[model samples]
Target: MTKIPTALLLTCDAQLVEIDLPFGHDCASSAERRAVLRAALRCDRFDVVALTRQWDMWIDDEGLYNHPVNPAATALAQRFGFTHQPYHGPVLLTGGPDAQGNTLPLLRHQVIGLFLTLQDL
Candidate 1:
């Protein structure tokens, strides 16, 4: 079975504010994923998390400067060996996949929570 991709937005306090993209999204297309991400950025939140079989990214404004990775995101990514890519104004947290070709949901949630916590600081 193909795993569905999902996106999540979290408040600055680790609360789940929104599910930007729910399961069953057309994650197979990078264009579709980018479109969803662009739409999610229009919201008032500073943190967004994308979870898919292709890639997983933790988007946050904190990593816009000299740091290639957001501190909190780095720590979390280190735990899972995820690669940190820099985005225009947010950090792109990318990582390896599991057996199902999906980035683990637990890791996605944990990364979002961590990003939110760091934003509060």
Candidate 2:
């Protein structure tokens, strides 16, 4: 006889079904992945995704960074438009993509990390 592993599945009627998947004989993954699941994000007044990892801050579609860990990213930020704090502080909220095709940044961060991607940086 083949023994199949089953889980205490929660049904729509709020009942637990102690059996294999209702639709599948065996549908399970050997590897496990972790994720930070939250009911909602702590957004500011503008509803932009706030940088709740720390103090009052927010990130944006623009590649600008107040303090970047990657040297190349830092250089790129400066090239794009990055000035010292107090000099270039947060705009609270900005209207993106002006006539010059430049995105308005969400100013609020101390140290930031950059990721290598295929999309427009």
Candidate 3:
């Protein structure tokens, strides 16, 4: 299965997860999705990668900082032990959309300016 070398922590919600850098597609079971997260973490170029649910309205309106499942997202952070702080202004959230207009259900934090921990990265 070629699982990722990095450690895996279960988020509070138990649905999502956060992986540390030096990350690879092996972190995720799905190749495509894993690639996306790996790329985002590696780039460290973007400020943040907002992940929305497929049917989230924000996809069309483009006005969601975090998704309803953000609690779950937070859980993911805690699970991975990724050190996190309050987000500053002018954050960008982007993702796919669904029938109701919801965006994809996942977001990745790039942490451009500051660094992060493996547990919280």
Name the better of 1 and 3 by TM-score: 1
Candidate 1, residues 1-121, lDDT tens digits: the string is 5332244443232334334342233556545545555554442234544444434655644435423423444443444454554243333333435665543333455555545644664
**lDDT, candidate 3, 40-95, per-residue tens:** 32322233323323111111122133323334334333443433632222222233
Q: Which structure is stronger by lDDT: 2 or 3?
A: 3
TM-scores of the models, in the order given = 0.35, 0.18, 0.21
Give the poorly placed runs of model 2, Cα more than 4 Å off.
1-68, 85-121
lDDT of 3 at 88: 21
User: lDDT of each model, Cα atoms only?
Assistant: 0.43, 0.24, 0.30
* Clashes within 3 Å, all models in order: 0, 0, 23
- Judged by whole-model lDDT over C-alpha atoms, candidate 3 comes out at 0.30
Q: Worst 10-residue stretch by lDDT in candidate 1?
A: 4-13
**Which is better, 1 or 3, measured by lDDT?**
1
Q: What is the TM-score (0 to 1) of candidate 1?
A: 0.35
What's the residue-level lDDT of 115 in candidate 2? 18
Model 1 lDDT, residue 14, Cα: 35
Instruction: Score residue 12 of candidate 3 by CA lDDT.
Output: 27
lDDT of 2 by residue, 1-121 (tens): 5443222211222232332212212322211100000101111221122222221122222313331233332232344445332111121212233345332332222112211210124
